[model samples]
Target: MYIDLHNHYLPAVDDGVLKIEETLLGLKLAIKEKVSTICFTPHIWSGRYNNSPEKLKEVFEKVKEEAKDIKIKLFLGSEVYYSSTIAEDFSKGLYLPLGEKKKFLLVEFASAVMPQGVSDGLYKLMLEGCEPIIAHPERYSYVQKDYECLFDFAKAQIPMQVTTQAIMGMLGRRAHRTAVKLLDEGLVSFIASDAHSPEERPLLFREAVRFLNRRYGYQTAKRLAIDNPKRILEGKSLLPVAGRKGKYSPFQ
Candidate 1:
């Protein structure tokens, strides 16, 4: 069963899945894509939405009830923004550390030029027991600026998710190139659509897996599409990956 770890299909809340109609459309798209499980990760950036864990559960139940016939098991989680706004409580707040759903926390950083020490905060969160899965590492201009920053995060041993669009080169050439580089280096841990709307960021796993199989072979592709993602859903220990060949500086 394919499980999509990141998506914004909760409806009428964040910038994604703006209404119930869009939410259902995204769900159907996921079903059509053959994804049996999907985590509804709406934006939990800073105080933008002070939704408590209880509130999250409430919405998850409602969405699941609505999507019952679709046969997709919806999960409870948030796509938290990694910024200074929650710097103090981030270790506890942004990173959803407890519960059996998943010990891994999915976090999205500000962009290439994010505030300094962003990595440090995530590192701290990791030390506190939650593994941080960086959302859309390929889209981060900072990662493109220096492919080594990703290695640095990898060195911290945190798993990173690459957007299917980035790998498809749909987001742009640089992101595509970097994604390829990361995959070649064996640094990528997961591949997700990070899908927002039904049209703009629709499911791209099948296309992504096909590309990975053609370029990197099936074993590597399976690791991204099948293995690592399964570990996330089960909250298991995420294994580390080898860096790309060639002695290179991370800043270069």
Candidate 2:
């Protein structure tokens, strides 16, 4: 069993699943991959998604009610797009933390650029008692060009989640390369599905774990996919990963 801390399975709220049926199908599919727990993190972007915590909660409750018999645990949260006012917004209940613990916030940045003062903003969020989990840093253009930016995040003690698709080379080559590099450097704290639809971004949790086990060893794979994510839900500190040495080969 593993925990998927980021996903867009919540229906009709964002660019994810559009219907309750899709949500159910996604959950069923996730279960098939041995995903025992999931956090329904819908997008909470500023202009694009603009989903409110209350609205998301309402939708999540309905989804929980519908999927109660699916033999999987479900929780509610949001993939908050970065903003300068994140701390203030979180205080006003404008954002939802992962698992509602009010401790960890799953955050994403622009795909093309790393915003100015984002590190400062994330630091301020940490000061306000929310540890930011940088979601899919491998997919960022800036990081793809120079993954060393993630060193700053690691130095700040910020955790990161690399999506299963990126590791599987389904997103793109740069993403796959960066994701593997992050893992090699022991910078990634979690591995999540980030699944959007049952067909498009289906949950590949088991496959990712299998791949990681074969490539990086089983303990490392389990740490990212299971142990660390469980720590987030429990409001505990994440374990530090011991990075593997040597350059990464795609087919290795």
Candidate 3:
């Protein structure tokens, strides 16, 4: 089983599923994908998503209740867009962190540009004892242009979550290439569905696990798809997943 740490399955929360039915459908599909856990991370961007943290939690609770029959774990969280006031906003409890302990925060930058003060902003969050996980660095245009741009983040010990579609080459070539590079260089810490709808994006956990198992070996796939994500929920340090075929030893 796998724990998917990033997804937007809550209806009317953001740009995800619109109805509760779709939410239920997505969860059922996730089961077929071998996902046993999921963290619902709705977008918390100003003006665009603009979802209030409280509202998100309320909807999350309702969805949890509705999906009680489903055999999977669901968590409440938000994918906050990077902004100059992000630290302050986080302090104000405007963003929901991952899992119950509220230690890991999932953050995203604009798809077209990696903000100038991104490193400084993440550093500030770290200083506050909040572990930040960059969402989909592989999808960033800047990162696509220069994959090495992630070196600073890597050195800072910040974790990153790559989308499953990008890893499966369902996205464009640029995104696929960048995702593979990130995994190949050991910069990716988690592989999530980043699923939005039931069909358009849907869940791809099984596909990703299969693809990664073949491309990077079974242990590497397990680390990103299972172990690392479980650590985030438990508020534990993530184990390193250096991507090299036939190099990683089997988990004992």
TM-score, one value per model: 0.88, 0.95, 0.96
Q: For candidate 2, lDDT tens digit of each residue in 135-234? A: 9999999999998877778777888899999999999999999998888877888899999999999989988899888877878888889999999998
lDDT (Cα, tens digit) per residue for candidate 1, span 7-93: 778776677777777888888888788787787777776567655656667776777788778877777677777775444565455
Ranking by lDDT: 3, 2, 1
Model 3 global lDDT (CA atoms, 0 to 1): 0.88
Error of 1 at 130 (Å): 1.0
The model with the greater lDDT, 1 or 3, is: 3
Clash tally, candidates in order:
3, 0, 0
Residue runs of model 2 more than 4 Å from their true location after superposition: 245-252
What's the residue-level lDDT of 197 in candidate 2? 95
Tell me the lDDT of candidate 1: 0.74
RMSD in angstroms between candidate 1 and the native structure over all alpha carbons: 3.4
lDDT comparison, 1 vs 2, better candidate: 2
Model 1 reaches what TM-score against the true structure?
0.88
Error of 3 at 220 (Å): 0.9
User: CA lDDT of each candidate?
Assistant: 0.74, 0.88, 0.88
- Model 3 segments beyond 4 Å from truth? 246-252
